[model samples]
Target: MVARQFIVRHDDDDHHIEHDTDDGFEVLQSQIFSLTLVPPDQQKILANVNDAAINADSDLAAVSDRLVLVSVQDQREISISDEELARLLQAEEEAVYLQQFQASGNRREFENRVRTYVPQVFLYEDPMRQEAARKTVPVDEIEEKSLIFLAKETSGHQTMKKAMPSYWSYSLGSKNLSGGTSGMGMGVPLPSEIQYGGSRVELYWCNKCSKETRFPRYNDPIKLLETRRGRCGEWANCFTLYCRTFGYSSRLILDFTDHVWTECYSHLLGRWMHLDPCEGEYDKPLLYEKGWNKKLNYVIAISKEGVYDVTKRYTRNWHKVIRRRNITTEADISAVLSDITSECRRSFSREITSTLKIRDERETEELETNVHIPVGDSLSLPGRQSGSKEWRMARAELGSSDQNNSEQRHKDEYVDSHVTRIHAAFSHLTSRISKEGVKAIKKLLEDLRASPFRERTAVLESQGIPHLGDLLEAISLKGSVRPDGRVSVGLAGDPVLTSLALPVALDVVEKIINKGGNSD
Candidate 1:
């Protein structure tokens, strides 16, 4: 049998034509043919096809036979013109550009833009044109054979079995209930009302501890299942396998942040629904079940349509849990869990109050020791007396001292008494301010400042004051009382003394003004 092969090239297409004959096939009209030559001393054998002869023959089959009988020994060569070559190159470039644009979602528009350029961009070489002139077998026969081979190779694998009706049962072993133990415990059953015609298989692997495991096919069940060992990613993979094994389309979806879950297409719903077995069953309230909650940390679900629906329910619940844990200063799991309860807000508020009380007490003691007050002969009353038992004893003996020292003792007693009264007043003011508003306390301070010095001193002495320095320090530290009852540096643009000194200064100023600005 003789066979003839022609290589044809167009601007953007290249194909081969083959003809079979009894004798060596002949090209009826020659354009270009392959030849072999020996060394310079030897003859060269050339093969050529006569295109005119083939065209002249009315019967193509008879012409093919005759051409195969004739042999011409000559090397045929055909070169493409520079312009044609440029055109071919241009066509190739355009094809690549159009393909890229199409891939980027501009297929129709790109094709329209290139349509006018296509004709000018493609040019056929002489050899290619001559090849195109020949006739050969139909193209469909070649395509048919190729498809047959592909089918043979692909269809050789064993088809997986259909899912069993019993497999749809929620039972693990004999248990009727769902979601308790692995294997023996009833697995979470697909809702019976929801018709699913796919295979089902369970998978298991630890995301954190075990090597990542991927099931070879959807139909294969996971070899092991352990509740505490695996994370959400592993659980998702298992569920996906179950659906795939049953011949239902399933996929393990992971978010950008490595959050893993399973998406199963429900034939009934005609949509993909996500399931998070590892996160546990959805709670009763949609917000509590799917919303941002502290116990679950971060949770977000994305639909196939590319919508991001992050549940703030989980987040809100988590925030409350953290706040409760922090306020109670309880680092235990129980405390953390308790905070997630409905009364979490009230519980945390109580904790905050307790902490504030402790802070206030410490602040009061510090203020009392830090204040300084001048005594007789430039001596500072309560000078380092905070740690002195001797000073306390001397002060305590003031009433029992001899008559000679009585005047001096009286002076000391008076200073002590005055300081005590100031301390008491400041303490009372703070208490009232805390209970009432700062505005009420500020008005009281204004009235005290307008009172006579003798009257204020008499009240202080009657109160049996002690530690004037402590009183001054407390008043100075507390600063001014704002209208809101907060102790601030300034109030209504006026600077007020510490809780201790506000009354004393107001009384002294009032007395001096009343006495026509006379010095004490």
Candidate 2:
């Protein structure tokens, strides 16, 4: 059986109504008839229907007023469930939301919001359950049904409709082909693999310079070629439009620092390559190799995964310095390069550490001044005084010889243990803050600090330190060694020196050890 569906909207009430007919239907505005037919007579009837309709209705309005009459010999049927229809509607809604989010530059926020709501919205909607109830048909059966419907609708006559090919077909071979029967011309040259093409245009705009920019040739032709100078964003957009006009897939990537570039998918290369047209001349390559060094390796490092890989490359380069130094194995340059790199990374991390340190200092000052105490158990004046005494006792409990050790030892040890970790964490944290802002980092830090293990574990993990449990076990097993070369039995399990005070005291010792080590 054949069916026709059309939508009518009333301007008076802005209401849309859909009308469906089983027989032949005439489109008023287009003066087109859709007809269904019986086996032997179907083709003959449809072939003459268009001419008959045109003769019967002198105008488009008269053609639209004509009633559609359809004849059916078979009773085969197909049905769609309400649940399936709902799911289809939901998918469409989600697609629209995603499109709007991307267009508004809120793609990330939209993803976050959707993630936050997905569970609540889809808690009862199970794909497996829906599929279990869904009807299934063989591929041939579906194809046969579709063909039958087409034959019935056309009344054996070919339908007159505009032909539009798929995007892939257009990109591959849509040009140079003859009308309707021909395909897009294949072998259209792809966009040039030049980096900073868009960026160059942007830079030119900033510098108030004007120049012609070239893009990869694709079948689709660009409209509105820009002549005046524009920024990197403008240039990148223009380049993207040109590529799109040629049926080439292109993207514009803008960085937090206002760095803009263009990327296009190269079908021949089977990879998306970077193009920075703004950085160098239009004809220059994207990345250039100078001996073993790769220059202008511009990539969008947007996530921890991306940054981690990039860092690994830098770390590997540092390792190469060891072999290239041409010194004894004992004088490996790996440590030197690592130290320099670590220092640079630490410099960046310091900003985060400094901010956190300021917060910590403020909290400490508030605690000292007894400024509002956090909500929890209340401490009486006597209890507070006793707590202070306990803190003093904890410090005084340390051995005289331990306190008398070289002051530099404490600084060196603390610095060694904490500085590298602090630097790395600080760097990661700063990067997060730079991309997502301070509020995100602050919330993350707050969550981490609330956890029993604290975010310090992240620092330890990065430094390849043993797990906290193992460290605690080690501290428990080897707590204190006396000057007499004997293990202090009670001290091993002492809460004061072994567990409570040791980690804090070690921080000081670490600073001293590092200071002395650096001096040597």
Candidate 3:
């Protein structure tokens, strides 16, 4: 009838606590019993200030500002492993999300909805089945009885695990040469076939009359199961579903730089393991960046439980990735992802939510720490494991097998891209600017070219031209194009900018400082 509270600590657990009021003091004892396993009769609910038994809410209030309960049954605390608690919390959260999901959706549309939510990233692979089976099946079945046969079939054996990487890499299925392909649609696609992205287009070479058409990238796992084919997108999509179907808590990892993979909780290893089904690679996070020389800007992981930004997990050189990360502000990205994750757990208990928060922070610490690890040359770093040689070469996704050739070029690409941006936007100044200014600018370019990529990168980030109007801000030279197709630049009062210098150059520089406009 009356609301009350207590800060209860039992078994020396730092984080876990119990405090609630129900029917009476007896009910509170039952609550403590549930957590500490000390019978209500043996437990002593006492106030910290005076060790007095808290018989009633008034007695608890008399002891201190807040009530305190402690089990005096045994001299020692109860045994509760962190692992056991985490697994319990995770399962509880899953049930909440699943419950909310079931209350609102049609089973037939579940797979399609996942694709619509995250067109390119969602993993919704379901095997081919009859209409009755498809309509009747649910995720609950997979969650409950997934391992009854799947593990025994493909992944359970240690030898099969080793053979799997090579099989999926080379034998699973060949890459679809026509990327922008939609397979063999004799006529235009129906409304139901229209995908979220423009990826379902009829290719130029795909003659509908001939029926020899581009195969559209399939999202259905059952179809992928039969075909056993596709790019990394298909591989990860299908593989993640395999993991989920096998009862492993899995995530579909999407690299914005055109790659996808899987991460599943490895109870044997006590952590999540990276998996590239297309490459037949396992536990090699750096295989893409270090092995294939990928310039990753973003990597995100999505699962039924939550969404996570996992970019640092794949990248060794965080600075380079940061420079390329212009898609959105980092804060906005975090806020949006956190909002989505929070929405999924809106109905979850506060204790479960707290555990998730701790897990999120711990995962972040792990991923960020990984960002600093020195890039290593692993023997497992083979070039472009999945797709054909031609496709791999076309994508330039070679691994360490070709690292010797690409190592230097990789550095040059970084330096050149920045230097080229400088040239494209500011090179015109050489002709219109004063001779002294032109000489100084050319000197910097020469120095930048000769210096190491790291040095050049530092110089770019420090003061290089990010745009047409902001060239060499640290050096006091600025330029902007005029609205009427004219170039204007500013050279700080230097010897070349005297009465003796070209009047045209001075006029151009003055106009740039005065009226900033678009480039020609």
The global C-alpha lDDT for each of the candidates, from Candidate 1 onward, is 0.32, 0.29, 0.52
Quote the lDDT for 110 in model 3: 29
What does candidate 1's lDDT look like per residue over 54-90, in tens digits? 3322444444332221233222222446775566456
- Model 2 gets an lDDT of 0.29
TM-score each candidate: 0.16, 0.17, 0.45
TM-score of 2: 0.17
**Model 3: what TM-score?**
0.45
**Residue-level lDDT tens digits of model 2 in 195-304:** 22221111111112222223232111121132222334334444444334334544444332234445554433222344543432121121221111222221222111
Off by over 4 Å in 2: 1-227, 280-520
Between prediction 2 and prediction 3, the one with superior TM-score is 3
Sort every candidate by TM-score, greatest first.
3, 2, 1
* lDDT over C-alpha atoms for residue 184 of model 1: 24
Ranking by lDDT: 3, 1, 2
Candidate 3: lDDT of 492? 39
Worst 10 residues of 2 by lDDT: 158-167
